[model samples]
Target: MIRRKGCSEKGRRSPIYRVAICEDEAPIREALLQMCRELLSQLAPEHQVEAFASARELAQALADGAPFDLLCLDILMEGQNGMEFAQKLREENERISILFITGSSQYLKDGYSVRPIQYLFKPVQREELEDALRTDLRLHHRPRTLTLRTGNKTTVLPIQDIRYLESQNHWVVVHMREGQQTFRSSLSEVERLLPPDQFCRSHNSYLVNMAWVAQTGRRELLLQDGSQVPVSRGYYESMQRQFVRFLNLK
Candidate 1:
């Protein structure tokens, strides 16, 4: 595994970002792994990088609860090809970023279905690899955990698990798949803490997670949880544009 130090508070350590590389060719896999370690050391700072020789091995690791934020996949392989594995993987996960590396451009059109962040031709250049990695890092730069204080109690919530946030007067309600938590904070204050690309202002009183948005109408948005959030006339156009951009980027 590859590891590096990250920027953090005096008493807190940076959250670990997990990355995986799967390539059947040993020489190519080793070269890619080293490049990732070197690039991520400066780009992400704190991360865990793992390499796999086959798609099955990586899939098994995922089945055993391994978490990866980014995947570097080689197109042609011995048995199950990278494109097939990525298509299957997308059925279950829609957020993870994929970067495809191949020697031939024959399968370029097929790769678009899975919506990879970028594609690289083999004999990969360090500059091109760095560009793909930079895009992935920017998309996932939000803090993993959010600290909330209510009365005398303080709680930490995983940012990705949040579905949407509702503002009620002086208190904000944090909605999640598990339940809800009401905290004494302004919606604007919480919005400042979240990444702008991932979350958007649906209305003056509501902030919606773009990933949870299933449908959007002229006046409202339908979340994955089946709840509807209002979209004011002023924010509707911009919200739709941002949501479309988010979908394309994903």
Candidate 2:
């Protein structure tokens, strides 16, 4: 969803700006994709812009491990419409930016609930597109920081840097790319601080980041870093479902 661009690209953590344009009409879809390609080309040296004639195609691409930074959706389509797809994305992941393309202003009010960056009415304007693209770039490049206070020291860690969190008694250790930081906090308290779409509890003692989770076995969750996190019997189903959803997001 709101992945920090090239997370799994190149060697490791190489971020790329990716955009997905979903529109049923072929002409519009191609045109929109071209516009995005042209825009991103001017903005970044390396970028990918893809177009799908239907929402289903785009959804399938995402389900198949495609990384996308922003989604451009058309409200009306053949089967599953843009609104429906947007709602589904919200349920699965919350960080990806969404911009709706509709022919009328009537959908503007309805689109507010999805927290979209903006809407492009019929005959998309150059200025409007540029503004929305700029917003998208800012969100994708922004660093996600999380602050923790333990004893007399306070540590700030980027949310993406953290692979998972493990709690023991009243303290939780933040497992990150570099190393671990201990903080005086409960697992539930730490969970509350993170965005629900990105992290989930795999056990009473473990809070896992969906982004870095590589695989899930019968007894444990395997992270991309080759670390194993315990998964309790009661939390197994939830963790499995979360993992499936996480895969779908990529």
Candidate 3:
């Protein structure tokens, strides 16, 4: 719940983002949780965080009205692969930020379809995670509420509360301010639902909100929260021009 200056007037309600992590491996999951705790302690102590070992378990939790702003997911899992889980999650909702984690580069092609915020290799590094999270928080726009359906159940998600979105195959994972949820959808489709001015397609596989942008150079996009997102050659020029214009407007 780190409120930006000039965001509130006296007693006005302040905005809070939710973050979550879903990794099947215990060691990796613990590492992610520790990193989250460290980052939030320094960057956004008021934000809430939750952890899950599998998509099914996390999905079930989200059904209870949890708000997840960001999600860090591992590709391969015991019951359901991350991709399959993401598809089921995005099918029901499309407004949260998602970041994928895996040890293999082969997953990259499949990942792009989901339009994750970014993809990170396993053995999760603190610096990389921090950069991704911060960039996501800065760029999010037009906070709205979303309703998701799973089997006979429905879940309500508040957009402002989301920190980011992650892609797993045909599924997109929604990370909110309170808890994490997954859905079945593509990154392109999720982009359609987001506000263009706020969320920018920085890479073929990633879309980031401008507000979270801390700094940008010819080759990189830095998030205020301290994460660095790559500016691919294909998208570099267009993103640079658009970002420059965005700055000028502000």
Write down the TM-score of every candidate. Answer: 0.54, 0.53, 0.52
Candidate 3 lDDT, 106-191, residue by residue in tens: 77888776678899897778888876776675565233554556566767665555445656788767655456678776777666
The sequence of per-residue lDDT tens digits that candidate 1 reaches over residues 79-163 is 8989999999999987677999999999999999999999999999998997787677666544667777666677878777899
Full-model lDDT for every candidate:
0.82, 0.77, 0.69
User: Model 3, stretches more than 4 Å misplaced?
Assistant: 1-14, 141-250
TM-score order, best first, reads 1, 2, 3
Name the candidate that leads on TM-score: 1
Q: In model 3, how large is the Cα lDDT of residue 15?
A: 45
Candidate 2 versus the native: TM-score? Answer: 0.53
Write model 2 residue lDDT over 149-223, tens digit each, in one string.
656676677888899999888888889998898877788776755645568889889998888988887689888
Minimum summed lDDT over a 10-residue window in model 2 is located at 1-10
Off by over 4 Å in 2: 1-14, 142-250
Superior by lDDT: candidate 2 or candidate 3:
2
Question: Comparing candidate 1 with candidate 2, which one achieves the higher TM-score?
Answer: 1
